[model samples]
Target chain A: MQEILQYLFSGITNGAIYAVIAIGFSMLYNSTELINFAHGEFVMLGSLCMVTFFGSMHLPLVPAIILTITCVALAGLVFERLAIRSVKHPEPIVLIIITVGASIFLRGIGMIIWGKDAYSIPSFSSHPPLDIAGAKLLSQSIWIIAIFLVAAVGLQLFYKKTLTGKAMEANAISKRAAWIVGIPSKLMVMMAFGLSTAMGGLAGVIIAPITMSSYDMGTMLGLKGFCAAMLGGLGSLWGALIGGFLLGILEALGVGFVSSGLKDATAFLLLLFILYVRPGGIISSADVNRF
Target chain B: MLLVKRYRSMMMILSVLAIACLLVASPAISASGKKPYKIGGIFAVTGPASFLGDPEKKSMEMVVDQINAKGGIDGHMLEAVIYDTEGDPSKAVMGVSKLINKDNVIAIIGPSRTPTTLAVMPMIQKAKIPFISCAAGNKIVQPIDPWVFKTAQSDILAVAAIYENLKSKNIKKIGIISVNNAFGESGKEQLLSQAPAFGLAVSKSETYGAKDTDMTAQLTKIRQDNPEAIVCWGTNPGPAVLAKNIQQLGLDIPLYQSHGVASPKFIELAGSAAEGIMLPTGKILVAALLPDSDPQKEVLNAYTSEYEKKYKSSVSGFGGYAYDAVKILAAALKNSNGDKEKIREALENTNGYVGVSGIFNFSKTDHNGLSPEAFVMVKIQDSTWKLLQ
Candidate 1:
């Protein structure tokens, strides 16, 4: 039972990261209707940027994280204005291809910059194990869960209460209507890009301390995030949270009960089964566009 | 004046044509006189497994530089034509074909992963070029091909070493966790087949996918079995995740990992949990932990110093094995005086060639340069490896 709890805790920790990254994916897709395949590369860049700034440059952790997120967020904005804006007038398939091409291009650039070596950011907390109900929990895991929850709540509040946030949501619903109402739809779209990239950067900052940062680290994480977003209904923020956490827990349970080698396949299999049953996602259709 | 101008233009055109002809003929004439001895290197270089290939390529470059510095091999400069296999077997075969048919290399040196090496083996045999794999799968050299050799010790040898180390601790029940790749599958087979011989019982076995980040579920099942030790066989991120999960579960049992987890990145990723983990690897690593006067001491010291200076990072077992591969190949080439058949014979006849890893004794039957005697159990202590008694 204690062992199960440990697995549950670690699963939640990992799931929290997936949830955060999925939220980022949903936010961009919601506002811009663009599937940012390169979103995971933003996370990779964030982590690599932090490693370079902190691990190599010996900068203070706070400053390094701030610089990483800011740089990555700016990169997202640039990517939007430069690469994505050009394709906005094109078909959705063309936009998808552009994003994927951008993903590959960014990955190549990351390899050149980071030299294809794995790097780790030192943990924010002590490296000691914490005893909880006869199971050991890493201090970093606690930080991961706490940060994810805080970010989720903060985002919920921002969307529900803030004026700028409402304007962004209005833009997502219909850009023409938002523009007619003087919401500065273009700026709102760029803002959404910045917000999503920042969230991905934060996930990178937190997860890099545990999973060493590599140029290709984004590939799997990106796929999992995409699966999570789809599972939750791509535009539903709360659904993304639920979907991400559920997927993580199911993967943990699958690896425990089923073959460990099939853990990844199990998640995809579940996604397929869910899609087959609902034809949409785990979330209700009425709430599909509730970003 | 017009005739003179025509003459000048014709002279210019003729000079340009003469230069182009010389440029085309120069390389052919050079090639016609004496062929450059070509060695093909197929490495990952740009993929998920680039970590392994990056260091291997560096070592290859270092060896080539050292050899060239000494005025070439047997009066002819040795040229290494490299192809990136991208850690895929299909690409590895393509690389082998390119090397054999296009580059016409005398020998091929890798395709680092076991699957890639195995994929390219039939082609290597068909082409009759000596193939030396740097991967650790025991089956890589089995049913020994007359033209194939490997500097990597077999998984059986490493697994036997693991069992021996566990047996010394009187640990009888062991759980196995491995990746589903060829390397991990090979390790699983070796462990299951050899555990009974070592007086150990298999308590449980679990596997995880290559890209899995959370392995807590598998660790949970293995913990339920209450095995004396958990044996993990996988590369980087996977093993690191396993160690983290074990720490999270607060499992105090010893964890015995494969040499794949010997990189410093493992400890860095696992944090404090990496301590007390025992892994069997080539002795070339943790050489400093061995007794100072040991027979392999001098070689290890030299390699450690040179590699540290060259790469600016602490060397791992992969680097050590690569170093040994180059040195062994160089020795064989020197002894054979560049005769391809004689070089193959000399490599087969290599006996008691002491290296940083172990004393290699290659024979016609066994292509692996070392036996089980080559592995030493090392425990991670305070982020550094300490040789186990």
Candidate 2:
């Protein structure tokens, strides 16, 4: 029973990370109507930037977080202006390919800057596992869960309360209508890119202390996050959170009960199963059906 | 005047061509008719396995410089042509082809990682060039490709070293958590094959992926079995994370890691969790702990001092593999008259050659040329390795 609990805690903890990544993906897709493939590289950028700023340069954690997220957010803005915006009437497929190119380009730049060694940062509060009823949860796992909730809640508030959020949603609903209504649709799209990239950077800062940081880390995290986003509901923030958790928990449980070697495969397999059953994700099914 | 100008331009072109030929042939001419012997090296000097390849390349270069400084083999300059594999097998294959086809190297050294070295073995054997590998996989030399030899001690020998240490502790049951790759898989094979002979039982076996950050799930599984010791087989970061996870779970059993985590990089990654975790590796890590009477002491100390003095970093075990390979190849070069077949024969018949890894005694059947004695049982103490008695 305790063993099961341990697995459950880890599964949930892992799912939370995937949730954060999925949220980043969901936000960009929500506003742009184009899936940003380079979304994963933002995660890499976040981690590498943190490692450089915090680990190498000896910046304190709080400032490092702000600086890294801000830097990645600015990168996102540049990516929008330079790569995405440069394209005239690009197909969604073309935008995705460009994002992928952006991802690869970022990875190459990261390699040149950081080289290939896996750089690790000490935890924000490095402590031993909190043992409860024989279940050990890493202190970092606790921090991960807490930060994930804060980000999720903060994003929810941003969407529900902020003027910028409503305008972005209005643009997503119909860019022409939003532009005609003086919502500045172009700014909303650029804001979406910046916000989404910052979210990825935040995931990097939170997770790097646990997984260690490397230039190549973004692809897998991005892929899993994409699966979570797809599973939860495309372009639905709440759906992304749910999807990320489900995938994370399932993968952890699969590794624990099933074959350890097939741990990565189990998540993808669950993705295929979920997608087969619910063509439209749990949250977006209503909106998808109406469309 | 036009005819005279044309003849003058033609003479100028001929003289320029003559100078180019002389410049190209200068080394051959200066060596008194003995052309410089070219050696090709392929190391993953800039990728995931840079920890291994960077040191290997640097050490080989240092050895080559020292040898040339003393004057080349029989007065023929030794030229080293190196390529970076970047830990990719395709690059390794390309490197081998380029060396054999374009560089026309008499011999080749390294590919660093086991998979990369294995990927190029068939090609090197088919090309019939003398190739010495620095990887630790037993399969690399077990079938014994005539042209291939490896200087790094094999996984089977590493297992023996571990078992010998376990016997001293009177611990019989063990668990293994290996990363699913060539190095880890090979270590698993050897551990399973050799355990029963040592009166040991593998109680539980689990594996983690290369990119896995957490091994607590595997460690938790191992914890249920409650083995006397747990062996973690992998390279840095993963094994380092495993060490931390083991500590995090507070699993009290002694953790034994493979030689793949021999470098100080592992200690830095694992932090305080690295303390008291034992592993079997080349004596290079604990060279200072070795007595003066040790045969490898002289070579090990010389290498350690020279490398540290040059790189301003302590020498790692990975570098020792290349250092040993170059020295043995240099020895083989001395006896073989620059003939590839004769060099192969000379390397095969190498007897009582003391190297940093071990006293290498190569035979027709044995290509690795080092035994279990090559590995020293070591435990991390206060962020540094201490040799176990």
Candidate 3:
């Protein structure tokens, strides 16, 4: 029972990280219908920026975090302005390729600035593990799960309750109609990129202390988050959360119960099975029915 | 007048071409008027394994510089042509092909990781070029690939070193976790195969992905069997993450790491979690702490000081592999006299050559040229290495 609880905690912690990254993917995908393969690099930027601000520059935690998020969001805005806006044809495939190119470019720049060594940031508050029924939970894990919940709930409220959020969703549905309604569709697209990258940055800062940060850290993460997003149903906020958690829990349980060598294989095989059955993903099908 | 006006432009062009030729040829023409011997270096200088390649490249460059400073190897200057493999097998193949065909290097020094070394091995053997790899894999030198040799202590030796340490503590049961990559797979194989001879029982052997973020589940699973100690085999970040995961789980078993995480970067990445972790490593890290009676003390000190002074960073055992490779090649070069086959034969006959890693004694059947004595076990304490007795 304690072992199960421990696996659950591990799964939930990893799930939160994946959810954060998955939301970043879903946000941009919803607004622009573009996958934004470079979304992971934004997370990389966030973590490395925090490493510079908090670790090297010795800024206090809150200020370093804010600075890191702002810097990465600005990078996202600049990336959208430069790479996405300048594309002669904004075909989804073409834009996806451009983001892929942007990821390589950003990674190169990161390498030049930071080199290849992994850098760690101190946790926000250092404390001994909290014992809950004999399962150990790091204080930082609580912070990560809390942030994940906050991002999900907050983004959910923004999309459903606020005018700008609804406007963004409207822009997503029909760009022509939204433009006719004076919704400023271009601004919404740019805002989606900004908001999405800001979330990515948040994930980076929170997780860096645990995972450590390097230039190429985002490559596998971005791929994993994309899988999570696909598993939960792309463009669905709650779906992303459930998908991320499910994937994390499954992976942890898989690692624990099954062979550890097949950990990733287990998660991916489940995803393939789910995709074969549902086609639109676990949550996206519900979303499609509403449309 | 017309002839003079037309000829003036021609004279300018001729002068420019002549200067370019001299500029290109100047380095090739050494002080002794002898051609420089081009040495090809393939290192993963800018990737996940950059820790290994970065230092290897710098050390090779440092060795080349030191050799050239000493009036060349028997009046023939040594020139290093290094290509970054980025830890990719295909990239290594491309780099080695270019080195063999385009660079026309007399001998090659590296392709820093085992997989890259293996990827380029068949080509090296076919090219008949004397290749000295800086990667640690028994396969690189085992079964005697004549043209292929390696400088780093093989995985079997490192495994023997680790097993010796475990035996000292009388740790009978061990859990093994390794990253599922060439380096980790090789170490895992050695760890499993060599266990029986040491009277150790392997309990719960697990593997994690190279880029895995957490190992709690693996550790949690390993905890069920209740091993006396756990051994993790991987390079930085993975092992570092595993350390943090172990700390979070509060599993109190002694954690043993492979030499893959032997650098100070491992400590920095792992933070306080790195405390008390033991690993077998090349002697360079604890060079200053070595006793005067140690045979490798002088050579290790000289290389460490030179490298630290030049690079403005601490020297790693990984870098020492390249340093030894270059030194070994330089020894062979002195007698080879620009002949590739002679270089091969000379490398085969090298004996009692004290290097930063160890005193290498090469032969026809044994190309790795170092014994298990090449490794010394060290423990991390207070964020620094404590040389174990």
Per model, kept true contacts as a fraction are 0.56, 0.39, 0.65
Clashing pairs in 3: none
Of all native A–B interface contacts, model 2 reproduces a fraction of: 0.39
Per-residue CA lDDT of candidate 1, range B1-389, in tens? 65665565455447545643432211111131235567777877678887777677666666766776676666655677777777988888888898899888777787778888889988977877777788888788888988888877788888988998888889999999999888789999999999999999998888887766667778878878789999999988788878877876677899999988777778877777788899987777777777876788888888778878988987776766666777777777774655678878888888998886688888988788686778888999988888887
Q: Give the winner by lDDT: 1 or 2.
A: 2
Question: In terms of lDDT, which candidate is strongest?
Answer: 3
Better of 1 and 2 by TM-score: 2
How much of the true contact map at the interface does candidate 3 reproduce, as a fraction?
Answer: 0.65
Q: Write one digit per residue (lDDT tens) for candidate 3, span B74-99.
A: 88888888888889999999988988
Candidate 2 lDDT tens digits, A164-207: 87888788778899999999878999999999999999988888
lDDT by residue (A1-291, candidate 3, tens digit) is 988998899899899999899989988888888999998898899999999999999999889999999999999999887678666568999899879877877887788789888998777888888999988888989989887777778888888899998999899887999999899988999999999999999988888888879999999889889999999998877778888999999999999888899999999999999999988789974565211
Per-model C-alpha RMSD: 7.8, 8.0, 6.8
Question: Which portions of model 2 miss their true places by more than 4 Å?
Answer: A285-291, B1-34, B335-337
Error of 2 at A126 (Å): 3.8
Better of 2 and 3 by DockQ: 3
The lDDT values for all models are 0.80, 0.84, 0.88
TM-score of each: 0.90, 0.91, 0.95
iRMSD of prediction 1: 10.8
lDDT of 1 at B346: 81
